[model samples]
Target: MPAPTRALLLIGPLLLFLALVYVLPFLGILRWSVTLPEPGLEQYRAALTDPLVRSVLWRTLRICAIVTVLSVVLAYIVALIWVRGSPVQRLVVELCILIPFWISVLTRAFGWLALLSNRGIVNGWLQATGLTSDPLTMVRNEFGVVVGMVHFLIPFAVFPLASAMRSVDERVLMAARGMGASRARVFWQVFLPMTRAGVIGAALVVFVFALGFFVTPAILGGGRSVMVAELIYLRIFQSPNWGLGAAISVLLMLAVGAMLAALLRQARPGGGS
Candidate 1:
């Protein structure tokens, strides 16, 4: 058999499985989005015009943006230590960063909820101290949502940066040192520029992941900071508006696809970051 034919045969089962599980369901959603609710694009039209939907969309984007920015910045610092630090330091950092991955998302979200809630430990501590008399609301708001998402996403942002950082030449740094360049100068100019692609790639990944976040926002936002994912759930489950929900789902999928495409382009050789 030809190489291409053999290759196709090898992965054909996986392709068929994905088509059955993913493509078919996606097609169903696309069909429902347009044909339901008395047909036409009524559902999509409503999605565009509805103020609540618009607000959720805006808030989702805003929160995702904030999470991506914060995650990348913090992850950069973490990745720097991860790449440049001593072996003991690297092992400790890896343990701290990787622990979250082993926990379920619900567990993590609820943990954040417990920690940040009005009567939670943080607020309790503040009240115990001379900080404030009343408990400050933390969870069930955008702040809590951002905090949760950034925590979840930082590990994601770190590895790509660490990969980029690891690929940096120690000889180049030594040469810079030999030239009497300051530590800050070498890092700011030589090191950072080399890792630009990784930073952009990590940011795109973090942003895209943040866009579809449901559980964390649902738990942390406490319905107060309803993002698109939660809004979709409400429309589908609570309102029983299948058409509207499907339309929103399609739109969200498209937005995610666009971001992923940009990330892919940036990752390709000779592709401009």
Candidate 2:
């Protein structure tokens, strides 16, 4: 076989594995969405025009946006400190980020629930301190959802940003300072520009993860606050509308794909997308 053919043979198993595990399953969902209750566009049409669907989609987008913003900013700070911190500080920071990853998502969500519930510690403390007469509603709403998502996503953001920051040259910052550039100037001109790729990659990862988030949102968001993933679950298992569930899932995948495509298209070469 030619060199290209030989290479293909070597890589074929991996590609086939991905296709079988991911692509085929996804396509099966698409098929299910279109096939049930007769092979037609009705499911798609309902998914598009249904007010409840639209509202859930909008809420998901809004929460994702909030989570992305919070995670990115927090990650940037954590990454900056990690990259510039002393050895002991760096170790502590890394551990702080990694420790949460070992903990289950449900565990983290419940922790937040304990902290934010009306009669929970946070509210109890606030009331005891006379900060407020009533417990602020933190959990069981958008506030809870965003908080849980941000907590879960922060490590993802930090991983990429920290990786990117590590690639930045320390001498470059020193050189800029040596050349009489102010600290702010050096950061914006040198550090920020160099870390652009990592930041974009991190944001993309966080946003994608946030889009399909189920457990955190389900536990924190309550019934009134529903994300698309939860809605899809309700449609399929609770209501037994497999076709509609599949359609929603497909639409979600398309929406995520479109956003990622737009990010890639719009990003500059040095910037991560």
Model number with the top TM-score = 1
Q: What lDDT does the true structure give each of the candidates?
A: 0.92, 0.90
TM-score of 2: 0.90
lDDT of 2 by residue, 130-152 (tens): 99998899988999999999999
lDDT digits (tens) for residues 77-145 of candidate 1? 999988889999999999978998999889989988888888999998999997989988889899999
At residue 184, give the lDDT of candidate 1.
96
Worst 10 residues of 2 by lDDT: 264-273
* Predicted structure 1, TM vs. truth: 0.96
Assess every candidate by TM-score. Answer: 0.96, 0.90
